[model samples]
Target: MRLLILGTGGMANAHAKNFSAIDGVEVVGGVDVDPSRVEAFNAMHNIPHGFGSLDAALNWGEFDAIANVTPDSVHHPTTMAALAAGKHVFCEKPLATDYARAIEMTEAAEAAGVVAMVNLTYRNVAQLQKARELVQAGELGKVKHFEASYLQSWLVSKAWGDWRTESQWLWRLSKKHGSNGTLGDIGIHILDFAVYGAGSDIDKVFCRLETFNKAEGDRIGEYDLDANDSFAMTAQLENGALGVVHATRWATGHFNELRLRVYGERGSVEVQHRHDWSKLFTCLGDDAETGKWTETEVPSVPTNYERFFEAVQMGRTLEPSFRHATSLQRVLDLSMLTDRDRREHEVYL
Candidate 1:
């Protein structure tokens, strides 16, 4: 598979490295609005071609697929263009800035009959994958409740770098810069984590989002740090399980972590991915009687990058398809409404 990496930002490096490592895939080119950045990225990855814009790359049109590492707002336009050009796409999360645009992209991808998928990165977590399998197999009989969270201390720590002066971090804090704040950013991951691990779709959601002041007068040059810093959500699963889902950049101690606990009548499961390692624990059979949780062996799974290559080769989309992402975006869209109206909202998809 010949792959063109879009955006050439920080995440784009991961895309280029992972795809280039795949035996059948080649990171042929890269596209970015900044010529120097794209040129540097191409040199770093040993790629042969670099284009200043998506249009230029599409006109060159040598790649079979594109790894869309663009900002949240740019996903729609770049992805649509790729689909129109009959190229398969592996897009970054959120799919689009809003549900309507996500639906349009999903529908267009389906109509184009190409392999289109979203990078819900956590799907690569072995523990998450195993927990979902156990739940589906009735090991966790009839999930009744779940608690999930995605936490980061980027706002309070320089572990990831100083967000105050960085464009990469500042863009995520401004709505005009195409950010959905904490809810739009990491919220999607936690929602997917809880919903997918519980092995059910979200039926409804009640959300409360908070935007904490990070700067004096709440203005950072051209950026307004008004995007949400924290959010808490109550969600109902289609299978009748109730779950609490939340995420925040203000989580002081943690750098980056995703944790989930699923409770059922016959058994329970817990999964955590922190600092790149993952572990799964379960309470089942007689152990459930004593509430004793034991660690379960979780096998490694293929990463989303590998899966996208496989999908392209097989000519069929996989689990984290644009359609599935659009479904998740519906919950996210409704989450904003619920926060604004201060009421619960039913999720349609």
Candidate 2:
């Protein structure tokens, strides 16, 4: 498969690495707005065709797929153009900044009869899949509660300096980029994973999103700031399972800590990140307290990015299908759309 990667950001770099290693796939070209970025991508990956604008890649005739790894602000435009031009598209997550555009993008893909995939990479985690399988096989019985969190300290202190200083968190904070802050970033990931692992859809959500700190002066550039750094939500799934999802960029100690736990009638399972220790532990029901936890040791499966190309080659379903991606976006929209006064409204079963 010949692919055109449309960004030279960090995520794009990761995608390039994976695509380069895939047996039948070739990253034919790349496009980035910055000349330095495009040049760097071509230099590092040895890609033959490098263009300074997405328009060049869109007009290029040799590419079979377009990877829209650009920033959140331009995802819709790039993906739509790629789909309209008869190229299959694989977009980074939070497909578009908002729900309506996300719907439009998917509809256009369907209308054009092109394959579209969203990069919800966490779903491809092998241990998470094992958790899903265990739930479905009744090993965990009736799921009662689900909790997942993505905690990162990357934005904990603006004084220490970070990539965010380049732009006053506008890409994540502005309405033009879709929803504000964590709801669109880390929150959406956990929401999708929760629904995927639980095999259910969220019927309703009650969220409390906040921005505790603001850019003090003019150092963080100039942008209309109306986004949150943290969000906590309680969701009621269609399957009678309750869930809590919390995502924050302000956590002090955790650096990209992602953890998930599910409690069910027969047992419970938990997963913790960055630990060489047994990643999954299940507590099956028993009368006595004699070490009821089942220690399921999971060997890390190979990363899922390359598998995406393999699936594309075989015409198989992508891990988080495009429809699933849309559903995840819907949950995000509903949560973030709640009025400020009702951000913490309760949903009773």
Candidate 3:
């Protein structure tokens, strides 16, 4: 498979590495709005073609698929363009800035009859996949409660600024670019994982969001910190499950910790996805007297990019489907309103 990468960001680099790792895949070219970024990626990967504009690369028409790693704001247009051009597309998370746009992108892909996938990388984790299987197979019967939290300390420090401080990373802060803040970034991942792992679809969501840390005095970023840094939500699922999702960039000791727990009639499962170590723990059955909890070990495995590529190649539905992705975006879009509603001591769902 020949691929064209649409952005030269860190996530784009990760995607390139994964595709390059596959034997039959070739990264034919890359395009970035920044000429320097395009040149750097070209030099780093020894890519055959590099263009400073996506339009130019699209006109080249040398790739079978387009990796739309552009910011969330442009995801819709970029993916639509790829689909209209009859190329398969793989986009980064939060499919589009909003649910409507995501729906439009999905419609375009469907109309064009091309494969489209969102890079919700966690869906590819083997342990998480196993958890989903167990839940689906009734190993964890009738999931009743679910919760997920993704914590990162990067925004807790003063040195956390990167592309987020520039217009280059549009939508990283502004709701217009997408839904404002952490909800769009890491929160969507947690929500997607929770809903997917529990084998359910969220029917309703009530959330509260906060922007405790802004780009104020002595801060480390250039753009206005107009987005939330933390959020919490309660959701009702289609499978009669109740769930909560919490995400924050302020946890001091937590650096990229994505944790999930689900409780059901038969058993409960917990997942810890972190660097240095990752594990899955299980508690089977309930005890009143001895209060015993059975612990089943979950083995650590390799990263998820490989599975994403295979799914796309095989033309199968990957976890965190566009339908699920759109639901997550809706929750994020609603969270912005929750922030304002709570300030007035009002609850909004």
1-349 per-residue lDDT for model 2 (tens digits): 8989998887898889888988888988989888888898889998999988877776666988888888887889888888889888888988877778888888998788767888887765666777878888887778888998888776765543564655524566655545457888877688877777776778878888887655665124545456777888888778889889898978887766677888887778776664233266777768114647665777666555665676667766465556667777777777766645576433323
Maximum-lDDT candidate: 1
Top TM-score prediction, candidate number: 1
Worst 10 residues of 1 by lDDT: 291-300
**What number of backbone clashes does candidate 3 have, counting pairs of residues 3 or more apart or in separate chains?**
0
> What is the number of backbone collisions in each predicted candidate, taken in the order shown?
0, 0, 0
Per-residue lDDT tens digits for candidate 1, residues 73-162, read 999999999999999999999899999999999999999999999999999899999999999999878899999999999999999999
Could you give candidate 3's per-residue lDDT for residues 7-61 as a string of tens digits?
9988888888888898788999999999998999978987889998878988889
List ranges where model 3 is wrong by over 4 Å: 158-171, 174-179, 215-222, 285-304, 315-317, 338-349
lDDT of each: 0.93, 0.76, 0.75
Model 1: runs farther than 4 Å from truth?
A: none
TM-score of 2: 0.90
* TM-score (all chains, Cα) for each model: 0.99, 0.90, 0.88
Q: Candidate 3 — which pairs collide?
A: none
lDDT of 1: 0.93
